[model samples]
Target: MSVLPLVFTSGWASGINAYAVVLLLGVFGATGLSDDVPEVLQRPDVLIAAAVLFLCEAVADKIPYVDSVWDSVHTVIRPIAGAVVAALLAGQSGSLPELAAGAVGGTTALMSHFVKAGTRMAVNTSPEPFSNIAVSTAEDLGVAAIIIFALFHPVAAAVIAGTLLALGLAAVVFLAQRIRRFWRRRAQRRAERRPTGPGVRHPVPTDGSEHF
Candidate 1:
């Protein structure tokens, strides 16, 4: 069948939307492991696996506060997703490879989640309706793309998926620091810019006593 669904699923799993797939693939292929797993490149089973992961991810994202809460659970889903993907990719390759793949996939997913979660936190600080709309639209587009790509190209899809995860983690690290620095600088500047308190009227020099 089509591998597009596989690609889409992997992409979303890494916090990307289908509309942005081309850009993601370009960046991921250029800087990350865009071809480490070949099964997604040509296997139906692998493709389906990616689809399953994407589906599970979508469901996980919908439970109201569950999305952010999931982040706190940590140590739970990351390895599971990785293990599952690795196993799917491994096929007959054996358990060791499967375990390794799982580890990679899970970790990749976690990194993506971290970055996205951080972004959402930042967004929530902004005006209401707009933030909700933005987050909802983003999630919708992302889910749609994953479903589309996974059904088409499993292996290549997973490769791109992995790349997204890696890139997301990198982004979180890079941006978190930059944001912190920006705020600190802004605070410092604001403090400096603030006007000083009103000056007290001085008594005549000869008086000395009274208020100084």
Candidate 2:
């Protein structure tokens, strides 16, 4: 089977939650559920590491500003992970060059990562944290579901992933100005609420009688 579908699907998922994608793929491959997954990923140590990181991400991703921080830290990590996974998938399938697959995965992951990070930054402008948590949870679940779908129906999963990515990017571009305005207003409000420092004040003359 061609690995292009899994490459795109996994790359997209990795951007949102690389650890979850790794753990899901590793578990499925280890359990004889999927043969397309690489042997290295199915190793117990790899699965354990991915699981631990995923748990940490799950917690960090739910917090408002913290999720943004986490995303910032993973800006490089996710793309690299995506590339590695894509290379491994290609190796397993023997249908594509590892270099080309890696390039596709890395680029796809970078685009999706930007989308996720930008959306989260905009979400962080809001005072409420529920939206952050909800979005994070949805992303995790979406990654898991997509990986499973890719295992069974790679072409359809890839198409869906591509559609979602396009929509996400379009939405981000459409809301960029609004997001900027929202943060600007929030900052302005914060500045207005800030306490003023003590300072000497000159008294105004009344009836032109107090000029000094």
Winner by TM-score: 2
Determine which window of 10 residues in candidate 1 has minimal summed lDDT: 16-25
Distance from true location, Cα of 136 in model 2, Å: 0.8
**Residue-level lDDT tens digits of model 2 in 100-194:** 99999988898899889888877887789999999998988888899999999999999999998999899889779756865686589787887
Q: Identify the candidate with maximal lDDT.
A: 2
lDDT of each: 0.48, 0.90
Residue 60 in candidate 2, Cα distance off native in Å: 0.6
Candidate 2: how many backbone clashes?
A: 0
lDDT of 2 at 210: 80
Candidate 1 structure quality by residue, lDDT tens digits, 93-142: 34345555555545555556567776544443343445545565676575
